[model samples]
Target: MQQADIIEGIKGKYFQKFGETSNPDKVRTFRSPGRINLIGEHTDYNNGFVLPASVDKAVYFVIEPREDDQVILHAADLDETYTFNVNDLSKPDQAWSHYQLGIIEQIYKKGLKIGGFQTTFGGDVPVGAGLSSSAALECCLLFALNELFDLGLDRFNIVKMSQKAENEYVGVQCGIMDQFASAFGKEESVIRLDCRSLEYEYFPFPMQDYLLVLCDTSVKHSLASSEYNTRRLECEKGISILKKYYPDIESLRDVTPEIVAEHKDELGDPVNRRCKFITEEIQRVQDACDLLVEGNLVEFGQKMYATHQGLQHEYEVSCPELDFLVDQTINDPAVLGARMMGGGFGGCTINLVKKEAVDDFEQKMKAAYLQAYQIDLPCYKVKITTGTEEIL
Candidate 1:
């Protein structure tokens, strides 16, 4: 369904659950978009740069403030309901409700008062497809609460809070890119976010002749989360050893390819490989941005292919299925670039394909992918869009 249809369906279910308000002004609605990273995969947590944009797929909400401290939440798509009191927030009966409660916990921890509310929320963002639906939901609700409670928090504050909610409450050690893109994304633009300084700038996405296509592997390997943490630890171990040589080095972001090569023996084994990929990927992001500025899409696409090689061989995050999908686009004239996106192991491969050839590209890939893996591949066609904001 289109985003407008999704919004209309959520609105209908919302009004069905909670009667129409006496004063319509008291009601609020919001859209929080899922994100796609064009390049710079796994570079965020290393305190590096990422090129990301919000997608049309989003988590939407219709909220109305309650007179009391009670908060009522209804998941329109799942047909689930969760209730909690502002005074006594605890573990939610539903797992997905934690994203909302996480925001509330962060608010209370900061000594901010947030009035309770009821909301019906759902979206078309495909979960586990590497589209960052969780971040979308968190940012969507946090933005709505910021306005609903008249809290003095700004957009960046909303981004950080949403990240903290996932890191602390949901126990995910994700970096700021996902939440940042969801909160600050602009239409037809991709953000170059400095994960270290929390600074960002938008580059007009020159996709007028191209299309962004995400092909799902439909398999999230069990190692996705555990190995994500392992990669972080490995990077940390490499940095800790590097500190002996250069005490000022904070993260892989601070080191360079030359520095990594100079200390290859000391960095050791997979640590060296991990740092190699990260340091190179960080530089690639800078190079890619420069190419983007010059409108050198062909070379920019080459950088994407390089990223996939590093992820497949050096970083060791790409699975067989992910690698196969990317390999298919290597020499295809229609496809400019392809890389595995998100926490890795298995998910979607984000591809830059010519708008004219997308149909044939999808058909060919689907046939080959299914013949190889015996699993159907689902492709998502996407466009860049604005970040989280209230619609009403």
Candidate 2:
């Protein structure tokens, strides 16, 4: 369904439940979109750069003010409802409600006056497909609260609050890129974010004949949550160990391949490999940005292939299905380059494929891959779209 129809559906459901309009006279709605990383994966937490854009897929929240300091939420996607006193501002019931509770908790912690409200939200962003469904929900709640309560917080501050909610309250050590893109992304432009500086610039993703296709392996990664934390810890451990020799280093971004090579023996094998992937991934990010700027899709595709190889060989994050998906498409004339995107144990493979050949290409991949792995992969045909805001 279209976003407007989705919003109207939620409003209709709320009225059906409450026997009155949630917004007595009128209601204010807020929207926040999910993001797709065009390139530069797994480099965000390492204090590197990432090229991501907000997608048309989004979460929409319709909210109405309340007199009491009690925030009430109802989500159609999960078929769940939650209520919490804004004065208390503690964690909500665990499970699906935490994302919304995390946003409220962070907003209160920011010294803003919390107010009571009723909200209903839903969206079509495929969960666990690496399209950042969580960020869409968090950002929607944050934006709704900001507007409903007249908190006067800017977009960046809202992004930070949402990030904090995810990091501290929701217990995800994710980087800022997801939430940042959800809040500040522009239409038809890829955001080049300096993760360290929290500064960004938008660059046109010079469109070619290729479609940016996301093929899901239908494998929900069991290691995604835990392994993600472990990888971050490993990177931190590498930095801490290397700091003894290179006092100037903060993250793996600081240690070049040359520096790591000099101290290769000292860092041991595991740390060495971890540091190696990070440093090289950082450089690839810079190079990818340069290539895109010069309208060098061919070179960008090559970098993407190299990136997958590094993630598979050096980072050791890609699984068999991911490996197969990428390997099968490496030499396909219609496909520019393919790589496993997201937390990576198993998820989607982002491919740049010739638009005209997409239908045949997808059919061939589906038949061949299903025969090889006995699992059907879902593919998303996406276009670059803007971030979210309220619609009158």
Candidate 3:
């Protein structure tokens, strides 16, 4: 979007609510980009590689500083209001507001004195669709607060705080990849992150002829949370059992596929299966990085398909809806490969499709999916984009 268009949009939205250009009461605005994990799902927590980019969709915030120590927040989409006092910063029962509150509490714990503010925020990203909408909201709020009080926090600091908010307050044991990508992503490049080391390198994404298409399965398995934790616990168990032999073994990441195979019989069926999935998944992540850097989209897409199969058969994370979507794209001339993305259960199947066939592929896939499931699927075509930045 053009700068003029952005200014117009911000002014229109701001004035419509506050009805003033300048006020003794200060105001600020900020935006944080939503992200799409290009590849390497469920590999982050295992200390493996992941490639993600911030997408075009984002969370926008218009905040006005207040003299008092009380904070007021209003969600444009929810049409709801929330109030929080800095002294009594506690989690909200409503759950959604806690995402914002959690960050504020963490920042204050770091000895930053923050005055209260009223914020009006809205965004277009779909929630719970594996698009990192929650990260968008939390990161934007962190940035706005940093500027509001002259906190002097760097980008990396902000990323850590945002991750802390999600892990401790939101109760999701996510890795740093999501928030890191949202804070530091560059346009047309995929970040190759070493999860164990927190080191990273950027490589140009050679997806020129291809489009990134997301197909929402419209089915969020209620067991996704429990199952995710279970899988994590299982990985930990495998690491524990292996540590008896290899004392240096820390995470499942420390054990290679070869090592797992050597001791495959030592582990029970479930533990061996979990270990196998993670070990192979990590290898695929490395191969994916090499393929993209070498500009081999075909090879990268094949790795993606293999990763999906491992997640389905060994990890047992894929569901019927996910399988159907991948099955539908098996022989598709347009799609090189399709697989379930995110923590699995049901969310979206990320696909590499020929740009020329995107429209027709969408029409055909939608008709077939709806015919089988009798529900319309939401599709998003995304291009690689930069992360959060100040509009001014």
Taking the tens digit of each residue's C-alpha lDDT, what string does model 2 give over 325-375?
998898798888889888789889989888899998889889988999898
Model 2, residue 96: C-alpha shift (Å): 1.1
Better of 1 and 3 by TM-score: 1
Provide the lowest-lDDT 10-residue window in model 1: 19-28
List where candidate 1 sits over 4 angstroms from the true fold. Answer: 20-25
lDDT of 3 by residue, 1-392 (tens): 54345545654565566565335346666878878876777888888888888877778887878778888777777767788786776667777798998898789778887887777787767787888888888899998889888999998899989999999888877789889888888888889888989888998885679888999998999889999999988898889889999999889888999988988898888889889988888888788888877888888888878878988999999999999989989888788878998999999998989999999888988998999999998998877777877655
In model 3, pairs of residues that clash are: none
Tell me the lDDT of model 1 at 339: 89
lDDT of 1 by residue, 99-184 (tens): 98898988887789988799999999998898889999999988888888888899988888899999988888778899999999
Give candidate 3's root-mean-square deviation (CA, Å): 2.2
Task: Name the regions of candidate 3 deviating beyond 4 angstroms.
Answer: 1-11, 20-27
lDDT of 3: 0.83
Q: Which candidate is the best by TM-score?
A: 1
| Model 1 collision count | 0
Ranking by lDDT, best first? 1, 3, 2
